[model samples]
Target: MTVALMWEARAVAGKGEELLTWATHQPLDPPPLRRETFRAPEDRVLVITWWEGTYDTEGLPELPEPGEDLVRRAVHRWRFETVADGV
Candidate 1:
């Protein structure tokens, strides 16, 4: 099945441009880039990306995560295979 990987993070202080730069410049291969973003009511931004490929976070490089607080960066990737017409 098709999958959609969503990630959201608040603008740190005045890091809006930095945030977008970091996300857009991520170095990941085998998964073609498909990214979109939006501004929330509270000014927080929501960035959703559709990665077309198998789901394997374990194999990907590790990202920075806060000790107590939630990840500044997160991923919600889902993988689904296609079905045959005769199946």
Candidate 2:
């Protein structure tokens, strides 16, 4: 099965660029099948990583949260499995 992990965060004030840089550099041991990063208005940063595994797979690699000073609130994360219809 294929799993996609989504991580999103909002940076503090004018630290959008810093947060972007930080998010892109996070390392996943053994790495994911695919990874992507994005930014939006309100200094929000989003990262999605795809891996080959089940949702309950143990020890799945995930990006850790950034330092408190860099973000205004806790990060958001979600996991999804590929749909049968491939949507």
Best by TM-score: 2
lDDT of 2 by residue, 1-87 (tens): 988999999999999999999999999998999999999999999999988987877788888989999999999999998878444
Runs in model 1 with CA error above 4 Å? Answer: 39-43, 52-87
The per-residue C-alpha lDDT of model 2 at residue 63 equals: 87
- Residue 29 lDDT (model 2): 92
- Which 10 successive residues of model 2 have the least lDDT summed? 78-87
> How many clashes would you count in candidate 2?
0
Best by lDDT: 2
lDDT of 1 by residue, 1-87 (tens): 334455556555556666555555565465545556665543255555554444543343322322223224443333433343254
What lDDT does candidate 1 reach at residue 54? 49
Prediction 2 global C-alpha lDDT: 0.93
